[model samples]
Target: MNTENAKPQQRFLPPPPGAEYPLMGSAVGGGSYNSHLVAGVLFIGLAAIGAIDWWLVAWIDGCLAIGLLLDRRTMNRKIALRAMPGQMLLYSQVALRAAVHMFPYYAFAFVLYLGMAPVVLPLNFAISSFVMLYGFYMLLRVYWLVHYLWVLNFRWEHAGRTFQTHQANLKTRRSAIQHVLWAFFLGNVGLVVRCSSQVITIAGFEYLRQSLNLDLTQHPTLNVHVMSIFWGTVVVWLATFWFMLQPTFLIYYRVHRTFHSCRPLYDSVHSIHHRGVLPTQLDSGTISPLEFALTEYNLPAGMLVPNWYWTLGQIILAFAGHLPSHDTNTWMKTGHHHLLHHRLFNVNFGLIAREDKRYGSFYCEPPQAASAPEPSGEAAPPARRRHAVAALAGEDD
Candidate 1:
């Protein structure tokens, strides 16, 4: 089979017309365009408003709900027009994908409302609105989950043999029980620990304040000024990128070693992610449960700032900036990098290009052209090339 010229299968249709690219350029490279300007402005406006009046969080939630509805309509139209497969199963998958994408925002809004609710009547209206909106979001998520499970069960029953063969070929060795246990433990238990630590820290601080006869209402270190909040959020966002590097390196190295070593347990888990040769937005979450715990679940766990507002800002940044990076082919290198990773497994192993570069493992497919590049007089020393090969070999030992 000649695989070089083979066209990759498409999973989801291209992102709906306007929501294709990240609002801002890639964090690694500063390249911005007009297409995402409206999204950028809207996100900034919402963040600014949120800082001044927490009540506006409800309005922000309303906007997100509207966006989700618009996305659903777009997907429905695609199905109706036969732009993509419109199987009843596909509809359920699309709905589940949307719910999964929107879950973070819904969870963030709920937390924002909990923290920002004021006793005054004017704000009480906002609180009421948030409560109602959150209730709807929860119900919708529940409905989506139920239908998703039913779809899974139906597919399992009807296509059990085929599905099992494909899954086995993918090299995923984890049993259903193991996957569920790891997913629950890492997803739920890790989240519980992270959230509880924050609560416990705050409670401990409050106890100290009361014992020392300090003002209960005053935050000792937090600068609640609007600009401070904005800048602080920015700092936290930047720091999050750096903080995630360690875990990204760990996950990549582990997977790379497992791939090379041909160990059944590790290879099976890692190969699940590699199954998506032509990746879609949905592929981002399509990983072994254990892999999910080690990678995506750990990305946000390193956050040092404990403020709910900071958490909300991170969610907004993720939705507004990072999520779209997965959908479109833009200057944002993430989508391109990930696509390359799927197609050319050994090259571009790190989450960010810099990691690959520092370890001398960076590799990208050369552009197709009629002429080759003119040879440079200077070439990398032999030792450097050897080191690069070793790094690419995942030689932690």
Candidate 2:
């Protein structure tokens, strides 16, 4: 064979017909594939023979496993892989969405951890208690201000159709009262559980760790449990955005369907929320206590995870989603999905996923005008000037 004309021998196995070969480089091999393999084998040997802590060995192996998962270089390839322009653009969009969604949860978790971690036990308890109750008012105020600004800025471009005239109604006023009181009560209970977890981690971590016999390494000068609590909470939020959110959306789809289809439950509990024929920002918080508890299931995780900050982050994230969903101005991207649910009670239940379509409940058609039936029990109050606080509370003014 002429040397110039000799074809290079194929290095990688051909992919199955019609399958697109991944062009990205493997995260592992792009670094030092042999080096990782040697190190991993050495660590496993050390762990198996009791020369090293098993927990430490496991951690290193976990990191190596993640590296292998991320590496794309191992994919069948005949040439050096480079990301295509379209692929790069898609990755950038995914990065931006993850940052926008997860930043707030991580920020809240950090703040709660920094605030409570250093305070003395009883004082920390008091502070967290204050955060749980008083934090709602602050959150509501901030949401109201931000939403008002958003509506003002985007009203010209993205405003959605409104169902009812914006007015203060007696029924909404009464609903607002129950909303505040219910939040106050539930907040206290939730924070108590969260704070108790923090106290236990601070005072009894060693005992608890030994009792559970979990495979976690101890830090020389720090409480590993405390570290895990904060970092674990942060990691959960990160994972939620990067991997878990879509699946979680499926779960909520079932939850919403159940709440809506069960007439006894809806009439007794969930109806308080449906009362908002045209939900406004304030109506976001005007849900019955039981419903609020059901929706905010993450807060209850403190019992198992002993992560107070996780619970606090959950509170922040819940209100962040709820407030915007109720904004009939449709400022946020997904606002119309829930807003449609309020108008056409039989449809548009799940938040982000099109599960309603899959399950035969999807309905996106809106009437030409606000034709939602009026609340049956209370007479609609006349439009009237009201106090600023009353306006913030979601009462018609």
Candidate 3:
């Protein structure tokens, strides 16, 4: 074979027309390009609020609202994936994906309510209790919505850029109808068992409360004083850290490893993610539906905090903590830890650096010298080169 005369093999090719189905995107990827606008507005809003009332939670709320408004403007730009004809189809897929992510939390919440109902009823707290439960559901919905938007936008932008190049090799596999139906059936059965146990637990609690004569009604209103906030903050932070550890380990041990074990599964499902070996923000949830569900199902487990305000605080704080993990910017260290995982699969399996270190999975190449900026009007590299770069940077076994 005359190697010099032969054509070079192409690693990344564009997807066929109308075949693109990306799972999700992230802020670290170009998906949330207008994040700076939102950040700037928030900084100003927070500064102004601090001048008037430094201790008010309303300041945080006000800044968030302004940031959302500013962020919404970015949506006005024509999003390539969103403009595709199969938007509803794509949304349905995303919806099902979201449902799987949330099913566990919803099931657990229902069980918790049933377990607490007896004690709540005797204290004449039924109405307030239901209201609080309903609020928690609504907050969970909002949190999921925020996550959806972040992933959706990133995927849209990513597909616009790379779908054409990877179209030839990018293949998507939908779960069979029978499998989906079976999953639904199993889910209902599990829910029933969970509810039954909860009912039994509630009975036990009711008996105990009655025997002890603990009048929760006397303390109807929760006293969230300064000391309470201090302790609550401490507890929420520790719990959030704990919640992340197990799930992170499970995803690496089970899902990541499983995909690597099956070539066909990896090609059809996992490869959609690894298509971009150098993962961008958009790469966060771009895996197969099963993988997505497995990795994210436990995310909302933190919402199980009994106190409504504390649960909300945990959600916000946890989200803030995760945002840095996905970030690829050089200034952020946490995201690089995860970026390394994407590059080298066997190592850095945990959520934080310490977990990988503790388990002896941590491995990273020393940081390279910064490259010079692309010249003005210069075209981006071809998809093949880009994928090649990513692969060279993080080659896996």
Winning candidate number (lDDT): 2
What is the descending lDDT order? 2, 3, 1
Cand. 3 Cα-lDDT: 0.37
Better of 1 and 2 by TM-score: 2
Better of 1 and 3 by TM-score: 3
**Candidate 3: residue 33 Cα off by (Å):** 26
- At residue 132, candidate 2 shows an lDDT of 51
Off-target runs (Cα >4 Å) in candidate 3 are: 1-248, 251-253, 299-301, 306-331, 344-346, 365-397
Could you give candidate 2's per-residue lDDT for residues 29-58 as a string of tens digits?
Answer: 111122233345766796799865687557
TM-score of each: 0.33, 0.40, 0.34
Deviation of model 1 at 156, angstroms: 26
**Candidate 1 Cα outliers beyond 4 Å, as residue runs:** 1-262, 297-330, 367-397
Model 2 error, position 183 (Å): 10
Of candidates 3 and 2, the better by TM-score: 2
Q: Estimate every model's Cα lDDT from 0 to 1.
A: 0.34, 0.40, 0.37
Candidate order by TM-score, decreasing, is 2, 3, 1
Candidate 3 least-lDDT 10 residues: 170-179
